[model samples]
Target: MGTIWTPKLNSYSGAKYLRLAQAAADAINQKELLANTKLPPQRRLADALGVTVGTVTRAYAVLEQRGYVYAKVGAGTFVRAEESEFKNKQINFATCQPPLTNQISVLSDAMSQLAKSPQRLTQLMAYHGEPLKEHQLIFSQWLHKRGITQQPEQIVFTHGAQQGIFAVLNGLMQAGDTLLCEGNCYPGIHTAAVQLGINIEPITLSDEGLDLSELEQKIIAHQPKVLYITPNNQNPTCIQYNLSQRQAILALTKKYNLVILEDDVNYCLSSEWHSPIWSIEQGSEQSEDPGHVIYLSSLSKVFCGGLRQGFLLVPNLYALKIKQAIHSQCWMISPLNTELACRVIQNPEFMGQREQVIAQRQQLCIEMGQRLGLKQRWRGLNGWLQLALPLKAHHVVTALAQKNILVRNGDDFNNHQNFIRLSIGDAADDKIFVQQLAIIEACIKSLSQTAYSVV
Candidate 1:
């Protein structure tokens, strides 16, 4: 065992790195890794794997993509304490590997074109100027496709959607106003709200997306100014708002005069993805007042999350305020990321890759449904399969950890002790994930009908 290298996993299969990352994440969850653990350098890990540095870079990228790891500029990657503990469950699901498919070339060509064109370079080089009208036009296609009638001019660029949140929050609310959110919302928003000293009132939810009645009641009772919602493929919970619900929510927003912050992050992932609430045509009975909805999205999901490129579609009336806020806090990203995203969206095969992933997700969902039924299942973009094991979810999660398949625990989504959200959705090795999830399901089934909180 002296001066020896062990082949832990194959990076080509992608699932191996995902499994390794998950195993490391699980250990961190149990306080085994401790706070601020300096992970093995990427080069050493790759050397141990007998693989290239690029392979290790990719694996770390996967971990970073799913918010499990953080990179310090000039320093090595380290486990994010809060994120690690949050993902502290056993999942057969692999990390989301952002495959550099052919569409990347499409982005390369755009960069090439941008480099060649002195006009684009001159106009887009600074933080103060507006993005190219062409960039605005391409973003408009994304908007129209998503059922938004917004002019490209209405769309403003940001470093990323996270910045967009800061911008919107800065512009829209004072320190004390409440921002109503879905009960099981994205963690980023939760952190942001807390940081700003803004109170968050979580509306209850289910398969039908938000509880409109409950939300309306909360709106009346609390009088929250801003309403945050992930209407399509809702985070953590795959719950989506149906057409009727959108209509009802719009009515309520107008009634309560709420400034809706619609985080339509996962909008493009679904083939049958419905038009967002803002995209719907407003009429005399339903003329949505201007500045009612501020839409947010990023190329992270469809293009490159590393691009850190986000776009905001704001109502014309409030666009100036949001834009000024963006300028004040998270100033313009390098035009480079925008060039990368604009390039990716233009690729004809870009949508094809999305479709392929969609097919993969459908198969995975079916496969997961068979292996693990609807008892505790919740499906979304990130393979958010919630197990029906109730109190046993924790036990099932811990048992799966022994085998080294990583998944997210459900309590992170909601305080429901019985539910476990299995991450089976995003960029994972489906074949291996299916097999491993089956094993986890078997492990859970074998455990005595007892629920013990592992923490």
Candidate 2:
């Protein structure tokens, strides 16, 4: 066939193969070449374009990843038949959820085992809604491995961590009560607080987690009933508290008579140093009391999101109140789901899979930073990018969405500044992720250029 589209290489677009792919896409969409057209084989294409077979192979991969073309097993590649439909399918990089396949496999195996014993399966299906001491014991043992010390009586089950958050907010704080959180708090926390008619003030964050001075001032002024916080791999920013920062916060808690609701949902992905703040407080030399921090954890992120199993490591004094509130709201979490979660935790491969996923995520962060010419390496599922361009966060996010890529604006996480949160776990694999980053890098450069011209 006649030359379909001439490949163009430009410095701003990064790799030569990537630029070639983009050039072909532009030409095809612009009607320079017809959709559903056939393309030359890799060897022929390399010869025609004066490049190596490897270059052509890689270029084809990029095109495939971008949904521009597809290859049959025996035939050459052809333009995708449904171009418009493919473009509309979004690549979501906003929400953070664990990979489903492996978790599903694990859960399936556990379910099969449970099915063998009809007696236990029937018992799990029954609505024994009240807090079950046996279920709590299983969950408590799981948490014990993570450095948290708790007993069956001190544990309360909820639908998930969000419900645990709601339960804590409902049971501890009255209507119109004030609560304190980091400047960029989780959106779920914000929504829960608003619906409950509880006032929440954001404490300014410093290089070291929460600004101690600002937190003290807020505590004095608002006398917040509880300080809800995510200490390790914090949502949106992935900010982990340092030793000194944790110590400082503990000291202030005593002075202000504060109740800390520690959201340790991301604790599984957290490193050894990123211990739960509750654990820190207990081990601290300055801490005299153990009941000040209310601990919360969930299997949603670690095991499977569909299970919706979560636990609250309530202080002995507040256990009854929290349990009462939980009973009124959801009665009991699905004992079936809770049992599945417990089995997954007990599985020998649980820790191995968790570490593997987290490591992959961290590597993705490094690769993204490198592609974007950034020096920072963010941890966990999300990486926060503080944009320097003279554009709104929403505008940047919209531009990405137009490219069929989705990411969260920092403001959605209560950040007042212009920033983007890229969910590192969004991409299914490495090649897809690399293509997504190339698209993002090109988009940002184009927008920055436009902004400069406007100025």
Candidate 3:
């Protein structure tokens, strides 16, 4: 450990220094500082900071209560190490990635088969320029399973859904143009929008979907060029829109002439598919122009992140613009990754593997809900748990980090609600999954008790 974090008392905006202490602990929690480190003793820290031991003691207590640090009978309290912090070991529910065992096994088999055919191996090395026609056809056929149909000409291959998002937004909107989305939308969208100098306005959310009243208000207020939506099993909240909700949003968008950027990247993992805004617009023959929706999706979540293969279903009207954007970026996704994706999607056994994966995720969700005494709020690979936290989410996240359990706090997604996203991608087995949840539960109970005692 370099040294116990000592906040510069005069610099912090608050007099209490509690937030400063919390910020120090959060830095440690996020691995900005090394883990398994030692914090200064209360008396020693007080002396250095020119503060009383009581203030330092209170701060330390808060840290301990929040699971950022722990005391021993003889040894000094220490910043928790990530790897060996918790008794049960670490569970990685932070990142959204599918369990790799089955994918690896399947890929290995596929690769071995591919290696045998010299002609195919040579084809993978050749560069098929922008809008790889054969690959587009293959993707269109695969996407048909999810009720998405498009001409090969309409598809643009991207490195991943993230890149596709950036490309489409960059192509459609100019600098300073406003983009509308759910208040707590995917971080990736926020990141892309910011990079392109596009302003984002958040619409209120409800159980059904975006609050139409608030959405229309924002639409009128912002005059946004595009609306990004994760209609099926939305990120962070895992809330899906029903038919009425979809129609309401479509109606508003149509009224405003706003382009709908539908990001259904995780649609493949969903148990049941909800009709996308693209489909709604496509089926509406009464509209003079039905090309209002831009669909973006990928196999990263369902297939393999390493493949980094995403496809875009651009509206026929915007095809040229999106293709220009795609060409400006990378010209094309690697032919190799596309081939891998094509092979995986074509494999008959892959569906069974997907079913098995979904089963595992559902089982974990059910168990977590039962243990926490909440209805399981999971769809596809990710689940959301709204925590009744005694402390702020930062403290809770830090506490969990100390325990070797990684989870995304709702605040990370611009969601002020006390929620944590539990992705089934990292928990490889059921026993470990349950054990991890038990740790989280205990931590919550412990924090709640501390809060009570303090009161």
Per-residue lDDT of candidate 2, residues 1-455 (tens digit):
53455455653253455556767777666766566788777787777778888667766775775567887888778787754555456777787765422454456558888989899998888888676677778777877886686667778888889999988888888889998998888889988899899998998776568988889988999988799878777777777788888777877887788788988776335553366778876676765557788888788766656688888877777877887788888776788877777788887656434456557766766675676564342656667777665656787799888788999998787786778887755554445566677787777766766645231
The whole-model lDDT of each prediction reads 0.66, 0.73, 0.74
lDDT value, residue 83 of candidate 1: 46
Which candidate gets the maximum TM-score versus the true structure? 2
lDDT by residue for model 3 (318-383), tens: 888877787788875688777777778787656434556567666756675676564347877788
Give the poorly placed runs of model 1, Cα more than 4 Å off: 1-106, 112-119, 267-269, 281-289, 376-380, 384-391, 425-439, 446-455
Candidates in order, TM-scores: namely 0.72, 0.77, 0.76
lDDT of 1 by residue, 69-134 (tens): 688887877767664543434444433323333334445557777789888677676664567778
Local error of candidate 3 at residue 436 (angstroms): 2.0
Better of 2 and 3 by lDDT: 3
RMSD of each: 9.9, 9.9, 17.1
